[model samples]
Target: MAPNVLSIAGTDPSGGAGIQADLKAFSANGAYGMSVITALVAQTTTGVVRVQEVAPDFVTDQLVTLLDDVRVDAVKIGMLANAEIIRAVVEVLDRYSPRHVVLDPVMVAKSGDRLLAPEAVGALREQLLPRVDLITPNLPEAADLLGEPEITDVEQMPAQAERLSALGAKQVLLKGGHFDGGDSVDLLHGDGVSEFLGSERVETTNDHGTGCTLSAAIAALRPQRSGWPEAVREAKLYLTEALRASERLEVGRGHGPVHHFHTWW
Candidate 1:
């Protein structure tokens, strides 16, 4: 049977990022996908205009109901807007102890709109980080987590990844997309092993949901019993291909999304 994957995140009515992107990436990667929406985002590829966060107790109810009935293999966590939602998530994660937990730490949107509340950062770092198996944070997110203003190059990724791992994450994939360069290099650090996964950069504005897609793909494929390194590599390759194909898809006027089913058609 395919691994059952769950995405706990906000909703993207535009279908480019958040729970929509996660579910697409999960199904495209051969996992049975499920979702629990934490917020309803009214946005397009252009920008996020508004957000409606779900009640914290309701969030717990959804998690409890799902875990009680479904056989979940892995979880991809994203866009927990506030401390209440973060605490709700932390509670269930402690209760069920899901096998694989991939944390995306979605603080800001592709359009530069803030997704996570500034007040929630402490709760997220304190209560949630310790439970996750892997954290896939882009450079900006890493810098925020580490209290650094910026991370400018590939050279800083290893040290940053190590520091993030010390924060209780079992592993860290520090993405270097925000760094200006010809090649996009990502560092995977965990268990006294740090490896680099580099690929030629695909320049395209249609890369809105790349982070969500990569983390979700990792969650879907991790159930294959592959190591974190292998899962990260595969997910990168998948994202690269998706980005390469996404240029042909003109979904929105501004930043469009990568093709989640690039391999299929």
Candidate 2:
């Protein structure tokens, strides 16, 4: 049976990220996609201009209603606006107990507008990190989680990944896209063991929604029971190809989304 993957995140109207991206990623892997909206964002490739959070009770209701019925194979969590919402998600996880969980700690957008609250960071690490099978954090988010300002060198990523594990995460994927170089290297760090995944960074300003896409892909495919490192590595390759295929399709004035339908069109 194909895996059923659930995504809990806000909606991005542009269809480039958030629930839309999650769904696209889900479909790319031929898995069923389920979603619970945490909030709604007024956003574009430029930045997030406004956000209206979903009611905490409503969020809980959606989760409970879904979990009580379907047998979710995997769960991918993104963009819970506040600590209360985070707590609500944790409660549901504890109750239903999905076999595979992927957490993409989406703190800020690629354009630098905050997607998660600074005050809620502690709740995320303390309450939610331990529940997940893998937590995907880019450099800035990793720094915030580790309480450090700089993770400039690629060599330091293993230590930071260890720090994330110490904070209750079973495994962490420290994305190295923001690092300076022609090549992109992502560190899959867990138990103080590090595996590096790399690709020649695509030369395009249209990269958007990559984190959401990659994590959702993993969640959708994970119940094949692949290891975390293998899942991440495969998803990275898929995302890179999507990036290359979408480089020329500048749909918007700002950063554009990946060509998720490249296989078809």
Candidate 3:
């Protein structure tokens, strides 16, 4: 049977990011996909217009009810909008103890809109980081979590990744996508070891949901793979291919989306 992967995230009515992209990535990677929405975002390939956060109690109810019936093999956590929702999620995670948890620290949108509340950063860094099996943070998100300036040099990534791991994340995948480079690089630090995962940078503006897709793909592949290293490696390869094929999609005018189903369509 395919592993059951659940995405706890916000909604992207545009079908390019958030819950939509997560489900697509999960299914494309051969996992059974499910979702529990955290926010309803008025967004498109161009930008986020407005956001309506779900109530914390309701979010908790959704988790509890779903976990009560479904055997969730893995979970991919995205945009939890505020501190209360973060705490609510932590409580349930501690209770059920899902086998695998991959957190994509979604702090900002591809269009430069803030997704996570500023006050909630402390809650996410101090409370939620320690609980997850893996954390995937892009350069800015990692800097935000550490209360430091965004890293500009690739050489600085290892140290920054180490600092993020010190915050209690079992594993940290520090993404270096923002920097100008021939190859997009990410550092995976865990268990006192670090490995650099790199792929030729695909030149495309249609990369709106790359982070969400990569982390969800990792969660989807984790159950079938041997360990974090294997899962991340395969996931990066998948994202690279998706990016390479993104131009085939004509979703919207701005930063579109990677072709999650490139294998088929």
Candidate 4:
């Protein structure tokens, strides 16, 4: 049976990131996808223009209503617009602990637009960080979470991953994509393990939604694979292929989306 994976996130009507990318990645990785929308974002492949947040109570209603019936095997969390919504999500997570939760700290977009609010950072770090199974944060997001400067070197990743793990996430995948390198590397730490996962960098302008896609793929593959390491390895391979095949798609003028259906289409 395919795992029933839920994506709690904001929207990207352009279909490159957020809930759109999540659902695509979920299905591509062999999971049945579900969604609870947290925000209505007016965005294109180029940038986010406007964001209208869903009410906090309604967000709770969406989660409770869905979890009451469906058997959710894993969850991928993306852009929660504010602290109120984060608290609402945390409350429901406590009530019905999903088997696996992957948090992609979506602080900024590919176009350099800020998605998460400044005030909500503290709420996410203090309240929600401890509740998730794995958190996938790129260098900038990790620095923001820890209130430290962004790391410039790969050697700095392990210590940062460890610090993030100490915040109570069972595991942390600290991404090194921002660094200039031949390979995109990530440090996975926690559960008494520290390993670096790397892939050959595919140079392309159409690399939008990589974070959302990667995290969603991990959530989708987690229940089927043996463990986090296996799931992450497979997911990274999927994203790399997607990046390599992105030029096959011509979506928007700016950083376009990765090809989620690279294997099929």
Candidate that would win on lDDT: 3
Count of backbone clashes, every candidate in sequence: 0, 0, 0, 0
lDDT of 1 at 28: 94
In candidate 3, the residue pairs with backbone N, CA or C atoms under 3 Å apart (3 or more residues apart, or in different chains) clash, namely: none
Question: Against the hidden reference, what TM-scores do the models get?
Answer: 0.98, 0.97, 0.99, 0.99
lDDT of 2 by residue, 108-184 (tens): 88788898999999999899999998999989889988788968889998888888999888888889999989999
| lDDT (10s digit) by residue, model 1, range 140-230 | 8988877877778778788888889989999998898887789998898999999989987998999888899999999999997568888
Q: Is candidate 2 or candidate 4 better by TM-score?
A: 4
| Candidate 1 deviant stretches above 4 angstroms | none
Residue-level lDDT tens digits of model 3 in 1-265: 9999999999998788999999999999999999999999999999999999999999999999999999999999999999999999999999999988999999999999999999999999999999999999999999999999999988999999999989999999999998897999899999999998888999989899999999999999999899999999999999999999998889989999999999998
The residue pairs found clashing in candidate 1 are: none
